[model samples]
Target: MTTNAAMQGKAMSVEEEKIQGGVQSLEVGLTVLDALTAHNAPMMLKELSEVLSMHPAKVHRYVVSLIRKGYAQQLTDGRYSLGERAHAFGVNALKRTDMLELSQRYIQDIQQHLNCSIHVSKWFADGAVVVQSLESNHVFNIITRVGSRMPLLKSATGRLHACFQPEHIIRPLLEKEWESSAKPEQYPANWEDFLELKAKILSQGYASVTGDMMAGINAISIPVFNFTQQLDHVITCIGTEDQLPEGQMQQAIDYVLGVQRQIDALFHPAAAI
Candidate 1:
């Protein structure tokens, strides 16, 4: 009995090292915050613990701490939700960030010069792409905004990221999302088609499609790379068929790619994307 107890105590001691405190607490806190941000509704203690695979006791402690610190609040149903402090922090972070500042200027320039709608997005995770900024000058409008997320398999930006991604990373990510969406409704048909499209998007420096988002509303996209040559962001321009004929699409692409280069320079001086 004594030997078993000692072994159990040693195992727990090792596990406690993984509890995430000291400087790591910030990351743990961010992890919780991120999960909350992704969810549309407030989460119960059990839901949060399940989502993070954290112990309820530990999660409760964090939730209570965040509540006391004004970053979270408890609902009448006892679920934890983001408080005003979270929104204020996010707003201030965006206000001070260079990405949006640079993205906005470039997007506006593209709109003024090309007279089109521009979408700027980043790869937030393996299976979702989030639009961080958008600009439209003509009568038509782009139906995306800051914090809007799109699925990996269906969205143009998502497809670009998938095509540019290294095979090892792309394959696993594809498989993971596929597993999650294997059921009815959202399940993708013809895996072979997806593979073929990804190959084409890779070969073409930019991807262009018409009627993907809406009929007559064509879209073109170019993946921007950071200084390290990693696909860091994407810039997409949208226009109607009447506004951009097939013959003029190449020129439009060149113009947009140039804008992308300028924005890339502004955000990452030495980077291309």
Candidate 2:
């Protein structure tokens, strides 16, 4: 890890919420944000509290803080709304993605050496997946257009980390994902199969598809970890079988793993910071 990254990544934690003395301020804030994001509009304190199952008094404290911090604001009617600060934080957080930027160098190297398409991904709140970045030898391709929100069960990139990453690491998220909007048919199989795939992916620590999601697209994906090296995002190499020749598939996997190690180095606190 670099000296600067160590200082920045210090802010990263596995708690999944803002640290507090048994009080999850971040969770409460997200609950409110979730309601707003779901409704696609501002919501009153009563509506937000009802949706979040939190008391109005407590919700008001959070709403007030959010307003002060600029993450949220009050409307003319006194309802809560996402403030411009929320978008600013998003854009700022995005700017810190040395991982995505660094990964592209590796992506280009892999594509040129392996002669295929390669990409990186980061998990979004739900349904949609962010491509983060992508590189390809082919002038035009169908795999993971940049900024595209990939379906959880539909894309190889989605399944790569979604299923393969450990439940201790992936569960709260997968559950939160389903809770947000679950239509089992999205995976194109029975519920039982989804469970089975979860097991298969976890056991294998990776997922590959000869033909799934979009037809004629072949992709192999491996999960990437955060500072503690827990599975969080994924790095995938995509290519048509026609473009892949002989042992190139295995080579691509080996290459991606190597790149993952390099990417991982940047996240480790000791070296990164």
For lDDT, the strongest prediction is 1
For residues 1-273, write the lDDT of model 1, one tens digit per residue: 579889999999888876634467777887888888888689999999999999999888888888888889999989989988997987686446556445667667776777766677777646445565455555656667667765456556667767776777777776766777644444234457568887777776777766654567777778766444567677777777866666688888888877766766754654443
* Alpha-carbon deviation at 38 in model 1, angstroms: 46
The regions of model 2 sitting more than 4 angstroms off are 1-97, 164-188, 245-248, 265-273
User: lDDT of all the models against the reference?
Assistant: 0.72, 0.67
Report lDDT (Cα) of residue 51, candidate 1. 98
Candidate 2 lDDT over residue span 115-162, tens digit each: 666667776554336565555657655456778766566566777656
Task: Quote model 1's TM-score.
Answer: 0.50
In model 1, which regions exceed 4 Å deviation?
Answer: 1-104, 166-192, 261-273
Summed over model 1, clashes come to: 2
Give per-model CA RMSD.
Answer: 20.7, 20.1
Worst 10 residues of 1 by lDDT: 182-191
TM-scores for candidates 1 onward, in order: 0.50, 0.49
